[model samples]
Target: MSHIKDVTGGTPIVLESLWKTYANFVAVSGIDLSVGAGRFCTVLGPSGSGKTTTLMMIAGFVAPTRGRILVSGRDIAALPPQKRNLGVVFQNYALFPHLTVFDNVAFPLIMRRVPQAEIAQRVERMLETVELAGLGGRYPRELSGGQQQRVALARALVFEPRVLLMDEPLGALDKKLRSSLQIELKALQRRLDVTVIYVTHDQEEALTMADQIVVMQGGRIEQNGTPEDLYDRPATAFVAGFMGDTNLVRGVVMAADKDGTLRIDHPTGRRIIARASGFQAGDHVAASLRPECLSIESPDGPEEPENAWDGRIAAVTYLGDAIRYHVAVGENRPTLAETLVVKAARRGTEHRRFSEGDAVRVRWSRSDARVLPPTRADARILPPMQAGGH
Candidate 1:
């Protein structure tokens, strides 16, 4: 994608103490955020997490019940949707079926009363930018899902609004197509240098396309950080599990030191040492261990490893690029420890050969274990033996 200079540059957005409440139910609660000029930020969560409602408020489609929405230092909380001069792309692609792609893309320009000749020129340029230059004569019904989505994007961007808001714009496409569009969309955003605030429930999409990710739960912000920060160091158990797959071991602080380290005793009697600041003995905690952070070896391996557990291989799943092994550990109250072996990291034929009933040792470094605040999601703890594996 080629970089296209436009008038949308250099405009930042700020939401100060923003909130929305209808009767006794609250949709969004006290959100404060700032989107830097030309940055891509994503609000991510499960259903009813208020991500979409927050986006609508930013687009002026839903008025804030309290607080301010500032655009480039000017408050636009009272402005109407059209008066805010922001672009919005919805999941449904909101295109006019009766009009040709060209006219549909030019609708915003027409509403703004730009000269007819300029509108035609700008629409044509946008069509070319979105790789739909030759398909402008076709109606929305005649276009493919991807093409129609491109048309909607072109329409929202053709006017060069200061900020572009996308609410699950790629959610309707197939996985392969959605993945392809994600790359193209990120490239297009950088090319245009437009501030984009995206809302989606897909963690993969958020991780792939966002410069910053704000995780929300129960109509409130759970955590906000860069992709790496959120993935490697989640603040809460919900975030640790929600952001990606991980094994959460619930325990209580058996010992604590002033140097930000603590020894946790699991309910199954397994002890784990982890790093957690500002916690004393007897504090409940959960350790989030990524699958890749663990390694498996022979049960009688000579080397002494930290956080080692002996288990019989219960199940193995072969993902395209990696192999996942679910091992059952502990005697009375067992827990499943999931370990991953990357195809590239496989040592030899022996590493690739493993039977379901073979005994193995699962171990991980102490530093890999991230101690976090306990959550309701972790309250239920491990699944029963009959059900097995998380």
Candidate 2:
């Protein structure tokens, strides 16, 4: 595997006000992004969210309806695909059926008219890099799915292209294989010192592999930041719900303390405290809290915390690693809370376990709650769950 220091220098790729539209439908709407040289940047979004279209435009496969694509300040919008010095690995391998692994990897070098000896040396080295050295003589059909994908990867890297573009290259593989290849591909990209623009709809894959993530929604960028930044402080309601599971509590602000505390009145008649950085009293707000930030405690556990709310256990689901508990307040929708299975089991034995009708208290820290604008100030609250229904 190549070390990060081995490939840290190169020219950055910039997308300036890029846009793509088909007839009346806009696919990518004025996206501006700059990818640092030798960094792994992932474009993440759901299907039909313009991630693929943006990638295609960058690869020169689809010409943009408007805007500019630059490489190290050079305008390459009109450049042919082959002339742009890029390596592309599509979802479908795109390997030549008649060519052996060696020939497949050597194709790029051959096109450049490299000497036969040099081509063999470069192809052999690439094969070793992808851990497919001995299988170079085998046809694509003879190799396993993972091995074939590795050959495709080696082919893309053998020619030492200036930039690499991968469009869901692991989308066709099984989960286990996909995870293994993601680590391998990230390591390889670092070793090769090549700029990479990766596109995927899988949030886990993007969070795990990317140095920076550009989250897209409805043909526009919702947020762009490091994984921790987006996870800890989501900038919008869509980002909070889309990135991970979040509990949204709709309420009206009752008071804003000078010490940065916000008192809010929930529709359920419960009061909660959140940060009051950008909000004022009498304003409507929505608070987003992660399930992991909440916990179910006994009614008699202790004095209520600053942000604790008393509720009844509505439902409990036992996932393999954790137990998910749904707690219902007076009239608000039940909020989900996840706890480690071991902890939940111990609590069940030592304390009054949260049965179908058990009373409990959900608590979190004020710092963990994120307050933002409400979805709709005039939206009506849905009916609360019945005794045994969550």
Candidate 3:
């Protein structure tokens, strides 16, 4: 779309029982995934999670130990990377330093033995489409990081491949530029209607850009669904912890009330009620409460919330649009992470701002909390892996 020319738009992809193993350990287990035509899908996980390995397999950079990759319903297990006819954009913007931008983008066409006249026309049009109309003569070393990335993108898509595979292509840029390019890339993909399978360890990036997210851990798929589904109804404690900021309170189911209300007893004896199903009395479960769902019960007040706790602010973090309060409940021990984190938006409102050290009442509705299967009491959030690629 825009100035970009569309070629036979897209194709579907399927991975059946995909597995990859080295001498000692397995990288990708028997995982199955399907991506619809023209859709954008992201594989998300922590370090050593196998997202990158999976992408490499699909791109034919790495071979699957035993499995089949189907592109548009045909088995491509025997195809080489070039024979697969897919576009790939890497994190390093792998452009040749010796060649000019135009020649770099024309490399794929030259390899295919396309005529020189057609290559010139296609390279010019692709450059114009990517907003690099007048910089064709410049070398990769002379351009900015963003420009080099655009060149890489142009080169990948110049031959009009069947599908696109991006491996954290924006990870090298700074935050502000990366954010801007995320929007730009998604818009471009939509206009071109190309099926995209992206690999990244950044959860926020996945949430922002993907139509579907496949969460993986230890070489297995934990959950795969729309972003809203994964956020609102995570099926596992790891999914809840990895998707966003959540306070996972481990407890035991005490009883099942009318409707879906579940009565639970916290480890420290704090009672909890949640709307859930498929859980009977005496089931050990963890309750997930999002930071945004909690608030300070203002005195000028609505009716008392369904769940309330008295705690003093233990710490405060100043986020631009919101404030995070770490409140230590009086009944629970500090060493146990019984501290609840509350997020309050800076609305410049008439009510009031809750400050640190304030003895405040924290509250949330029963519907705001979700009951999950039991998990370890001290599972930390997935830390960003900086040194190695996932």
The TM-scores, one per candidate, come to: 0.88, 0.83, 0.86
lDDT of 1 by residue, 184-252 (tens): 778878887888999887999999999999998877788888999899989899899998888888889
lDDT of each: 0.80, 0.77, 0.83
- Model 2, residue 100: C-alpha shift (Å): 2.3
In candidate 2, what residue range of length 10 has the lowest lDDT sum? 376-385
Give model 1's TM-score versus the native structure.
0.88
Ranking by lDDT: 3, 1, 2
Q: How does candidate 2 score on lDDT? A: 0.77
- Residues 1-390, candidate 3: write the lDDT tens digits: 012223355788888878787764778877888888888999888788888889999999998877778888778888999899899997764799999999999999999999999999999998987779999999999999888988998999888776999988877677887787788778878888789999887889999999999998888888899999899989888899999999988888999976888989877777887889999899988899999999875344554545887777888888878888888874647744588988888787433366667778788898899899864333223323256322
Candidate 1 differs from the real structure by a C-alpha RMSD in angstroms, to one decimal, of 8.3
RMSD of 2: 9.5
TM-score-wise, the better of 1 and 2 is 1
- TM-score top scorer: 1
The C-alpha RMSD in Å for every predicted model, in order, reads 8.3, 9.5, 6.7
